[model samples]
Target: MDTQNSAGTLYIVATPVGNLEDITFRAVKVLKQVDLIAAEDTRHSKKLLSHYDIKTKLVSCHEHNEANKTHQIIAHLKNGLDIALISDAGTPSISDPGYKLVTAVAREMLSIIPIPGCSAAIAGLSVSGLPTDSFLFLGFLPKKQQKQKQALEAITNQSATLIFYESPRRIKALIDNMRTILGDRKACLAREITKLHEEYIRGNLSDILKALEEKEVIKGECSLFVQGQLEQKTIDEEQLEKIIISRLATTELGTSDLARQISKEFKVSKKQVYDTILKSNQIDS
Candidate 1:
């Protein structure tokens, strides 16, 4: 393909997340026909290439060297050499390497195409039995316990289903954090997806935690789909009024502070609560 007059195309291909047969035919074709293949791990990708008889040259493009390789990849694309970008598993750049290279290619106005296929996040969500209408994909959380809890707290009010990827070692901790910060909502832990020993544990967060405790050792990578925060039932005006009065008499919380606390707890407007508090004349406006 002599596109010397014009820059070569950059193909973002998707590979199997687990099962070798999960890749799309288009992905295989692109991999074979491309002038070069930029892989997250050359050794890891070699096995997949060998399986399909693809002899295209491979270059290492992982997190450590992705920034440095981005320039070289762009140069190749400019010199009329079509290239394909793929990760060890699933599509590149989705919580994986290749984001930098893809962005560089796009900035250069080169033709960029996607030969999409398997994705673990989507696969796990499909079988999670949670609401599919809306979802938020959080690939992984911070390793520190405090940071992880803070991250979960930020999403405690989200109504969309939450999808997270975790390793077997930390799956237990991640589940516990979710339960503590997000409440014991329903969840599904999809492990070893699309593989021989694939398993899906479905139930409340507490149930999943109990099951994991019983296991001798948790194996394989895991994708957890957790139910989002549910809508809080509105508190009756009379009940709300009484609570406001009781707080005013019992606590030192001022009108503004008390209104904020009550509003958050009951999912009502802060102004509404504040007005009710003012009506009681128990706290100064």
Candidate 2:
């Protein structure tokens, strides 16, 4: 390979999430032909490689090592050796480390190709039986319960279906936050997708949580899809203003809680309701 290898390309390949044979033929061909494969976990990837009889060399490119490995991988591509970036499962950059490397490579004016195949997010949405025209893919929420609730609250009023990825260990906790903050909106949980014991449980968030708790143990990553907020109806400004004034006079709810309660009653966003409440308070003062 020429040191000035200007024609080098970076292939973003997609591996299977659970089933080995789910990989695309083009992906397999690219992996075998690339000069090198930068995998999230080379050890974990070896099983797939061995199953497919791929002889290409693989190097570690996970979250811990990606920052250091980026330069080396870029150097090889610059030296005219084409390379492929793959994750332990699914596409390279979806909630993975391929973003940094891909961004760096794009800056250098090298070609980057995508060999798309399977993605757990898309797989879950396809069969979720929810509206899919518009969606928000939240890879994972924060670990803290408060932070997770705040995150959900921020997007509670969006009319787009919400999708999330979770591990078996924290799936219950995540559902708890969703139910608390987003209410028991219709949802579906797809577990162990594409595997032998794969299952999809459909219901409101609370029902799904209750069912999962009954199982002695759970495993595999979970894909969750929630129906979007109800369509906004025609709101009456004067009517809302009167309700706010009456509620303040008649009830002892704090401003934030009042906003939450009123927002639900009127099918408006919490932020909008809160902002109006602030303005009302300022005007009274």
Candidate 3:
């Protein structure tokens, strides 16, 4: 391959997340033909390249050196050098570092092509036995408890399945927090994806937490898929009014505060609770 002749095109390649066989035929061919290959972790990618007998030159392109490497990659592209960007696993720039380089190259009107293939997040979710029509891919949660809690709360009422990437160390804490905010909703913890030890733990949030607690320590990377809300049975307006009025009577809090708490507890709108409170007050008056 002539390095000088192959300049200008940037190939964003998707490598196998776990199983080497998951790689696409086109991805392998592009990787082989590119002048240079930029990777998240060269050593990790080396194994994949070695498996496929790909001899393309590898360069380090990851979160740490992304800003610095972006210029170098663009320089290669400007000079008509074709380059391939790959992550340690899965697709580049999907919660990875290829974004900065891709964005920079695109601004210069350079050709960038995607060689799509395996992605653990999407692969796991596809087989998760959860809602697939709509989903929110929250790549990774904050490490801090409060931030994670706030993050989970922000999406608690979403009607779509929530997909998240989690580290083995923080997965327990993540599950614990989900239980606190999202109740005991069903979730799937898919780990060691597509590998020999691949596993998926499917159950309510509490059960998954307990299972993790019993294990010595989880080893593989994880992708969590949480089921969304199911249809709710309609409660009679009068019955709901009675329940709210009676609960408010036993509490000393103001009507608005009481209504807010009831709304959250019952998964009903605050306005509905407020209207019930007003009706109760009118009847008493």
Candidate achieving the largest TM-score: 2
Every model's TM-score: 0.82, 0.83, 0.82
**Model 3, CA-based lDDT:** 0.85
Query: Which scores higher on lDDT, 2 or 3?
Result: 2
What TM-score should be assigned to candidate 2?
0.83
Q: Where does candidate 3 stray beyond 4 Å?
A: 1-7, 231-265, 268-285
What's the CA error at residue 77 for candidate 3, in Å?
Answer: 0.1
User: Which digits, one per residue and each the tens of the lDDT, describe model 3 over residues 54-118?
Assistant: 99999999999999999988888878888999998899998888888888887877888889888
Clashing pairs in 1: none
Residue 180 miss distance in model 1 (angstroms)? 0.8
Best by lDDT: 1
lDDT of 2 at 135: 96
- Flag regions of model 2 displaced more than 4 Å: 1-5, 233-262, 268-285
RMSD to native, candidate 2: 6.2
Q: Please, what are the lDDT tens digits per residue for candidate 2 over residues 1-285? A: 212446678999999999999999999999999989999998999999999999998888989988889899888887888999999889988987799998888887778889999999999999999998999999988888788878888897888999999889999989876665665689999999999999999998878999999999998899999998876655788878887887778655578877876776467778987888888899899
Candidate 1 residue runs with Cα over 4 Å from true position: 1-5, 235-285
